[model samples]
Target: MEWAALLLLALALCALLYLLGRWLLGLDGDLTLLWAEWRGKRPENELPDKVVWVTGASSGIGEELAYQLAKIGALVVLSARRENELERVKQKCLEISNLSSKDILVLPLDLTDRSSHEAATKTVLQHFGRIDVLVNNGGRSQRSLFVDTKVEVYAAIMELNYLGTVSLTKHVLNHMVQREKGKIVTMSSVMGIMGAPLATGYCASKHALQGFFNSLRPELGEYPEIIITTICPGPVQSKIIHNVFTEDLSKSLDNTGDQSHKMPTDRCVRLTLVSMVNDLKEAWISDHPYLAVCYLWQYAPTWAWWLMNKMGKIRIQNFKSGVDADISYSQKKKA
Candidate 1:
């Protein structure tokens, strides 16, 4: 009986110490990231003059990444559904850097069209001879309960977010494998790491990405030169919220959250570039408290779930209120 009691006491003490270390000493978040940074080596191949293909390059982080890569002298290929916006971004890239029209190829692509990925890859290869880095940043977001969300909504998001990314990666993978050197950078999200409210389909799609890339990472052991970086960034100021697909398969333009807290797109892309340059396997880029949530999900899952549940309820309430307001306004306008 005394031995059992002692074992229980020991376990309790260990748990206490771990919590204290994680919360008070800052052991679980940036410190862990710092250790990773210290241990990581910079990629042997520099970014300059490298052929870097960025998808969803029309706006937000993708557009910012294109400009930054251009500044670094990379031959940037911009792809997205918006040809006009892509041309604008291309012009911006050219203005910011010494790159000319020939250096920055604007290849407008619809990620949902999986059949076109091979042709897109061929076009990129034909233009640049080879793609040194492929950034898979094209995806859609969702904001609705699973029960309320249409079945087709789930399929659409999964097709765009998961299958589309996978198809593009496959098209690029063959080229990377043949050359035995390349980098695949994927834009995941905090929702990818853990569950969140009103993002059931979105979370599932991001989780699928995590599983797919992580499984693929180990299989490429023979090719150490090839690197795969998955970036899970917390809310950054972007059109993602405005573009979020709702239960009825309509886009939400409510602007429902406090933009003050969101990180700037440029800042997010800068941190992501640092991770890419360092060849970090995975990175969660965000402000302090938000970035700390990833660690909470990792080290203290039960607590994380409780916190998320509370937050989820609040978000759902806000969403419903916003929807009600919109309906009332529309009715008044009709009257």
Candidate 2:
């Protein structure tokens, strides 16, 4: 009887210590080691002629990425819905590179259309011969509540975010696998790590992407030089805030939110570029509230992430801002 009582007391003490340890980690859980390890493993840069495709390049982070890659001498193909915007970006990149305008190709593509991916790839192949890196950074975002959202809204989000990426990836995977060399860098939001209350469809789509890529990451290792990288960052300073879909199931067409508090698009693009060059599997850009929520919900238990994500009212109100205000698609948020 005495032994049993002692064992129970010891178990309670151990449980208490375990909870205390977890609380301590929660208080100071920094990923400096992970960052250092990733920094140490960056691969050498590819040559100038390596064909790299940047989708959603009409504006935002995609344009930034295209510009950065051009500076590094990589042949770039920029795609988006707006050819005019794409042309502006291409011209800027050429000026930056001191290279001929022939080096950059502008292909406008609607990501929601799965059939469009093959045609776009064919154009890239015709112009550049073959692509060495494909950056899938095109997609729409949402700011609707799960309870208030229509069923079709979910489907549309999936079609654009998840299926759209998969379709494009499928189109390129065969060629990349055959050549045994390619880089597939996906732009998924930090919301991919944890769903927020009012951003149901966006979160779901991003989460699905994380699952798909994580499962496929190891499978791609069979190809000697193929690299698959997924990037997740907090709210980036961009037109995405103005692009929030409304509670009435309507997408906003004007900018009406606080864009000042968001992270700079250039910084996000540079980080993404460095991650890709380094062959990182995953990256999370640091920021305020959202960054904290990313961890509190991801490593936390089931209900923990849920409760933490719900601690906000900004999601619904952002819906009033016009999604159309994005002027160009957001490659960072689209990631």
* Candidate 2 structure quality by residue, lDDT tens digits, 30-65: 263246335554322544677888888877778888
What overall lDDT goes with each candidate model?
A: 0.82, 0.74
Per-model root-mean-square deviation over C-alphas: 7.8, 7.8
Q: lDDT (0-100) at residue 128 of candidate 2?
A: 85
Q: After superposition, how far is residue 54 of candidate 1 from its true place, in Å?
A: 0.6
Off by over 4 Å in 2: 1-47, 248-250, 253-255, 302-310, 313-335
**What are the per-residue Cα lDDT tens digits for candidate 1 across 246-308?**
887765546555444456788788767767887888988765444666789999999888877
Candidate 1 least-lDDT 10 residues = 324-333
Model 1 CA lDDT for position 137:
96
Give me candidate 1's TM-score against the actual structure: 0.84
Candidate 1 wrong stretches, greater than 4 Å: 1-45, 256-258, 323-335
